[model samples]
Target: MQLEARKIGFYYKKNRWIFRDLNFTIDAGEIVGLIGPSGCGKTTFGRVLSGYEKPQEGTILLNETPLPKRGYQPVQLVYQHPEKAVNPKWRMEKTLHEGGEIDRELLEVLGIKQEWLSRWPNELSGGELQRFCVARALRSNTRFLIADEMTTMLDAITQSQIWHAVLDIVKQRNIGVLAISHEAALLKRICTRTLTIH
Candidate 1:
């Protein structure tokens, strides 16, 4: 399986292209890093790849086909801000189960305590909430993961734990990962190859 962005272009305003004619691909089981300076549209590209936003030109293809308009998307995105990603009204358990049934082993690997599941999103620390967001995005149907600065805000220990769990799952499931971040050391540690946006 492969997720390919073919000659894609996007802009939020007229005559201002954040990125143009960009082509990229991530094959199944590969970990690709997207690294660039701040405000270079790396996050925008991730959104487009994950089907959260539409590109102004070109296409995003999964296995040479356009992405599905509805239903569970194979390309999932885990953003940097878990607080903004989840609903405030729902408990952590509900949010975690939104994608599908929660994998007990996954929870244990990510260091998510069973007691935390009963708490609200606002009740958890940033790192704790992010673990849930990561877990939710790794549902069985996910073919690719677009992690846009997913661990940037967490401390070194938390970041290491999350990446360890994520990489383990990626290897076991053969899921491709697109890691977007400005941290060169982190990228070098986890990604097989790196793509620069600018």
Candidate 2:
């Protein structure tokens, strides 16, 4: 399977385009790196691809079909900020299971403690909250993941741990990944190839 962005165009305002007529693709099991300057719409592109936002023009296709509008989305997105992605009112466990019943093995692999599940989002550290986010994005039906600076805010050790778990899961499930970040070294180490946009 492959995810393709064909002639994609997006803009916040009428004439100003964050990106226009862009084309890109990532095959299953491929870890593709996306790098660009600040305010270039990389994050916006990810949101569009994952069905969080609609493109003003063009289409995002999965295996030549439009993304399913209902049910679990095959394309999942993990943003840079975990705090913003999750609900403060819900406990970690509720937030984690919002999609469905998450596998215990996945929780174990992500280093999510049983006790942390009962606590609110604020009670946990950034890394811990982000762990739940990553696990949530890796449901069995997820065919692709758009990791927009997913681990940028964490320490080096925390970053390594999260990446290790995520990489292992994606490889096992043959899920495609588009890792958007500013770190060239990280892209070099994790991605099969890197794509840059202006």
Q: What is the lDDT of candidate 2?
A: 0.94
lDDT of 1 by residue, 1-198 (tens): 999999999999976999999999899999999999899999999999999999999999999999999989999999999999999999999989885797799899889999999999999999999999998898889999999999999999999999999999999999999999999999999999999988
TM-score for every candidate vs. truth? 0.98, 0.98
Alpha carbon lDDT of residue 28, candidate 1? 100
> For candidate 2, lDDT tens digit of each residue in 49-139?
8988888889999999999999999999998999999999999989999979899999999999999999999999999999999999998
Which pairs clash inside model 2? none
Error of 1 at 159 (Å): 0.5
lDDT, candidate 1, equals: 0.94
List the lowest-lDDT window of 10 residues for candidate 2.
Answer: 10-19
